[model samples]
Target: MGGSGAGGTNTGKRPNGQLGSWFLRSGWSKGELARQVNRRARQMGAHHISTDTSRVRRWLDGEQPREPIPRILSELFSERLGAVVAVEELGLRSAHQSPSVSGVDLPWAGPQTVALISEFSRSDLMLARRGFLGTSLALAAGPALVEPMQRWLVPTSAGGQEQPEDEPVATPSRASRLSGPELDLLESTTAMFRLWDAQCGGGLRRKAVVGQLHEVTDLLQEPQPEATSRRLFRCAAELAELAGWMSYDVGLQPNAQKYFVLALHAAKEAGDKPLGSYILSSMSRQMIHLGRPDDALELIHLAQYGSRDCATPRTQAMLYAMEARAYANMGQPSKTKRAVRMAEDTFSDAGVDGEVEPDWIRFFSEAELNGENAHSYRDLAYVAGRSPAYASLAEPVMRRAVDLFAEDTDHQRSYALNLIGLATVHLLKREPEQSTALAEKALKVAESVRSERVNTRLRKTLDTAARDFGDVAGVVDLTERLTAQLPESAEAV
Candidate 1:
């Protein structure tokens, strides 16, 4: 119990109970415990917990904790008890799980879903850290809702029809200036996010920054003059596309797909056909991730038609490469090779004049070509695994890719994966020392990024090592630890 104050007046008796018992065991005073609990609670916006002795006494006396307070209690008590003390044990069952919102699940969803998704997305950082297993995306909210709508807007009816050769593009120069704080803010934020995306990954940044997207969209919707407004609209369209990309990074596929569609709509409204095509390409990439290669192929073809002349050569090359990857995924070797050839041509053409190229296209270089080919070969190698024939392309392509993306900014994950891929190939080819060396390099790189994707792929390489190199004691133990730390996606990949 808390004793008298400085003047010897009775401050208040600390209630004797669970919080007190834990505090005694931990040798922390009520004031100290309260300070820590309140600090963490304030960070999470649950301000009900007070540092006052009376309230801490009530908790110690076995009084039930309220929402969020229980979580704080759990944290405080866990430290006291020298082990985890669940909120349920503290009589705060209400705080067992994080709060859930219904509608904000989708960025491009209607008001309700948007709010729900935003809330959930924001909470994911803490939830993930706490090891709370999230529910899988509900089946009803799958691609069914948006796919039909997408097909309707970009109907296949005129899919084969080409725009006239005489079609002219409207180019707005400095004379047609765009002026506004919103545009400036959008540009500033976009560049900042892009830089962060390369370093820490889109996953790490998306959860925190996506909330600002709504405000940006709102600003773009405000009334403005025609020319400036068009520019604002285009900027908004790009923002939406970026929002979609970030969504995919955090494993929210359906929500991301919806944002891509919304970006496409915004691009069309801004009369930016090339931007719309880019969004479609992004959507196709998501489709490939979802194992819908057929859909991905069709979307890439649509992008090719829509962006034939409007898009820069670099974007065209990227689309072709992605399409080739899709074909490789589908086991269509002939089409895959053909698409690869087209990708080469597009990249060569795009490299002709650096002066006219966009900043976004600068990453599309010879090194990037090596990286893309490596990924393509990896896809092919996976498909060939189920067949009788052994793979030949995976090792060489991965080797080239690792060399190419070595110096590329924020590509540490890819470099690690390429090394892992090389290791996997070496294991397949019965070169144990070579395989282990490459795997070690991959593990070092994986430690640098908070990427489950990199970790997961590395796990596959390690698992193979375990199976084939188990005879060696050192190899066996290393593989065991790597296998133990493997994430869920590791098995799937």
Candidate 2:
């Protein structure tokens, strides 16, 4: 995709050790970096730019690439490194980097947190207008989050821990405060947004979610009564977390990571350790989806350990399930099974009614756990040099997940995933007839949802079906339909 055409002038000819270090850590060859940058540039509508490996060499040799190139490379590496890598972090010293794109780092406990949420939400709106979802810039992951997570675990700020709901936090300013009833409305609105996200998918309501989240950030700048303030932060945390999930659904990894951090900060402000832990687990899920299970383990372990005293048993179960997913992705079946067992044991200890807890985690029921378990087994089944036993093991679990997931709009994505998973299981068993038929049903269900995650799984299943049953009429029909109708790039951003 690179061209040997006219481009930015090389600013220097010195050895750029900084860029070299990052290029090495990026796990990309020079040509690959050029290719990925070109693709990312095309996504941003810079169609004329055709960068090649020679240009990359010049960059590594301390040549300052022109405008947009620095920014593009920053976005690419940010996602690749699973951290918010600024241009400077990449040894890119171009003066053209936009301040809006570069200012991703935010303080954890301060007024600036409010500022970031406001600016981030507006920028999200701008990105939507530019044919992008959530954020295409300013995302961070893993090590970039270490300090913030540490802050969350042992907060230094006063009134940072759980307090009586009605108790006013120390040094409450006399700024205009939002009413408790008004905050209640905000909370209810957030719940409604969550339902819409699950039913219709993330792309449908991102702008609205970002807008409401921005409004909440504005409210946070002013002082409210203790109860109202905690409620406001709780609402903001929920909305921000939803925004992050929606971003993830659309395959915008950077956007998701940025919003997840915002949500975690808000959760901490609300003295909600459980919610903070949930946000960390969400970040871990993103890492797993992006195939960085090492990073996933780091986040999952942090979530499990940091919230040990505060997280409910169901929450613990969710964290352990995330742990299992990471290990399964690494093809470590033993550790994966151990984590799943721990998840099951902890979940069982949640008391038959699931121990009255936060509304957000109510979905971690038998069906959800079964879905996670099936996913672990499915991952193991596909691992290199694995035996067929895992494939057979996943079938019943996948079937149960399909049966348990309600046939309603609310559980549309999960239902479709189960169908696809079962189809994959059949494909692995070499049963083309059943696999293709089930895949057809999944394709129909997925057509109604707008999740790239769902699309990614469907693509993988179809690819397997094509490879294993290319001659089967049903597989041919399914493949034809998918090829003709869907062109979504399923790779995680």
Candidate 3:
């Protein structure tokens, strides 16, 4: 693969200037160059690249390499040469980068263009494993929102039809009004995800659900009528929102934010303000989880303001309660209490109608208030250094969230944190055994959820208990497990 024989093809010109400059300046042997390349490749996390003398000679003599190998070679040489080396300089520009979900040609693309989707997906997977919340936020809903809304407002097709793949095979239940192919597809997908969420956890199922939602989005894009099409689109949006929420739960904040925005677009087209509100609320919750309490507060306000007329009293109550949590986190106790009162007022108003809440919103009952307060107080406790009242509220509130969202890894993790909070209280009160037992119980639930935050907090509590209560074996063991999972930079390790 060398450029030519010793006497041929501009041999006296000493290869391309870029190649010649490197060789002459370094006065390196072919074999020595090969070794350098191999070392560089290893440092770059690359495996194969023959890196033999012959290959190095060919590369120096202006021979192009193949595909990814060429890119790696260029990168290696650039590092060694102390300059940027283009693929063309190595005569390997033709071997293009592989096409991902992004940087692709597609007719119908949403706000998460291919580039955004691919980056978001990889980011999600990485964040899930590392148990770190990604700090990316959603793009503003400007042109992205307007274009989709305008398109949906215009008539594209005469009638809506369901995909044959989505057809219902089983008889519909009396209580389950969901029928036909689209509804069947929706129910099945929801059930499948629900089960995965229980068994493997949301972190495991998030990608699959996101992919499915994208497929559903494509299917719903076909031209259809106003009413039926809108309903189908709304359902797809709901699924997308769920996928986003679960993704957020698993620490894929950037992707979750984009998906939520996409869900908002779909919901807007469907004229489903309530669903849009729910999506907004989900986004707000994610913001809070990421420790951006101010951003979360803004989102909650948006949700409450946008769905004032469309949302049911139950939904309103849920929104108010969420805002209360945000307010509490900000340490604005009066504002938090006001928000809680509003939620209570909404709930009381809804009680008169006795209207059933949506299945998705079923977890938002007054009985779940304890869990909400627990979460708020937990955040407050973290910010305030230490607060007895916050600790007191967190324990019972977390206990209730545990009971309600039990089997839910996310909630169970929250419950575990609450237990730790309670344990901290016990420790402050000089109760060693109670603290150790509570810490153990919290860790047990924590074992179920794939949460770095939960593990980190657990370690903090365990370490404190272990130091203060050195005789406690259980606390020591829990501390060890927590330490094992954390990076050395994290506390307790």
lDDT of each: 0.58, 0.76, 0.57
Question: Candidate 3, which ten residues in sequence have the lowest lDDT sum?
Answer: 1-10
| Candidate 3 residue-wise lDDT, 1-493, digit = tens | 3222111222332445566565666677878876765554443334444467776665566654444455454544543443434445654443333333212122223322323433444555454344433322322222332233333223221223222422322222333232367666775676567555544445556657766665555545444444445556576666667777665555344446566766665665566678778887886676565555666787777777777877888888889888987887678877877887787788777657777655556545554565666566666665566666766656666666556655554345456656776677676556778788877777677666655456646676777787888777766766776667544221100
TM-score against native, each model: 0.63, 0.82, 0.60
- For each candidate, how many residue pairs have backbone atoms clashing (under 3 Å)? 9, 2, 3
lDDT (Cα, tens digit) per residue for candidate 2, span 150-256: 65665545434544543434546465456557766888888888888778777678779989998988887777665666777888888889999988897777678
Point out where model 3 deviates above 4 Å.
1-179, 191-195, 198-200, 348-352, 400-432, 450-457, 460-474, 483-493
Task: State, as a TM-score between 0 and 1, how close model 3 is to the true structure.
Answer: 0.60
Q: Positional deviation of 447 in candidate 1, in angstroms?
A: 1.8
State the RMSD for candidate 3. 13.0
Error of 2 at 413 (Å): 1.1
lDDT of 3 at 306: 74
Q: Whole-model lDDT for model 1 versus the true structure?
A: 0.58
TM-score, ranked from best to worst: 2, 1, 3
Task: At residue 5, give the lDDT of candidate 3.
Answer: 18
Per-residue lDDT of candidate 1, residues 267-349 (tens digit)? 55466666777778787777666666777787777778777877888888988988998898888878887888899888888
